[model samples]
Target: MRIMAKTDVFIKARIIKGYSQRELAKKSGLSHAYISLLERSVKSVGPATAKKLSDLLGKELEDLFRIELL
Candidate 1:
């Protein structure tokens, strides 16, 4: 099964909030590299990290990430 990467929504939310990856990292207290990986869909975010990012982005976790199978 292939899992869908919903990082695009995360990216759009960050952009809408006028935050760069570095800025988001600072706000979310996550490393910039990790945020970069998240944006690139190269890494899956954990629940804790997802919560932090969703809070920072002013979005719900459900709106940020969607899981699918293929």
Candidate 2:
């Protein structure tokens, strides 16, 4: 049996909150281009950015960002 890997729910939460990328970025004090990178999983979110997004989107940190162990 195969299991699906857990995915970040950032886009879903952003949609549910009815905010466009630009809007969310402005609200979260980030740039829309950066937000695009985040949504696409092209960039990893740091603790500070995660906290900003979590508080702004009213989502749990784990729900929006994944912590990768090095």
Candidate 3:
């Protein structure tokens, strides 16, 4: 079994919040490239970075990402 990343959840949350990647990047103090990579699932976010994103999105960290067994 493999633990899949739920980058889609993050993307959906961002869209629902009406935030562009660049906007979120500015608010979260993360680079737009990093946000892009995260949404694309090319890079995994660390706990600190996840916290920053969740805080900016007004969501709980758990709601931002989930693990799925595959």
Candidate 4:
């Protein structure tokens, strides 16, 4: 499977929302390492994770992660 996270959008949104990766992890109940992987597009963001980020960053799921199962 391949995941193409819109990392630029995600990072910008996170910054605009006043959250560093660690802060976002804590707020969203995700691991910092996992957040890092997501941001780096090294791992696919699961649905639950996508929901959490979308809720926290006020970004739509489509804008953040474009995960396509191969």
- Candidate 4 has what TM-score? 0.88
Clashes of each: 0, 0, 0, 0
Misplaced by over 4 Å in model 4 are: 1-4
lDDT of candidate 4 at residue 55, scale 0 to 100: 87
Error of 3 at 44 (Å): 1.3
Candidate 2 clashes: the total is 0
For candidate 2, write residues 17-63 as lDDT tens digits.
Answer: 99999999899888999888888777777677788888888887766
lDDT of 3 by residue, 1-70 (tens): 2222367888889999999999999998989998898888777777777777888888888887664444
lDDT of 4 by residue, 1-70 (tens): 5556688898999999999999999998889998888888887876777877898999888888787877
Candidate with better TM-score, 1 vs 3: 1
Clashing pairs in 1: none
- Please give, for residues 8-47, the per-residue lDDT of candidate 1 as tens digits: 7988999999999999999888899988887777877767
Which is better, 2 or 3, measured by TM-score?
A: 2
* Backbone clash tally (model 4): 0
Show where candidate 1 strays beyond 4 Å. Answer: 1-5, 68-70
For candidate 4, give the lDDT.
0.85
Cα TM-score of candidate 2: 0.84
Worst 10 residues of 1 by lDDT: 1-10
Query: Candidate 1, residue 21: CA error in Å?
Result: 0.4
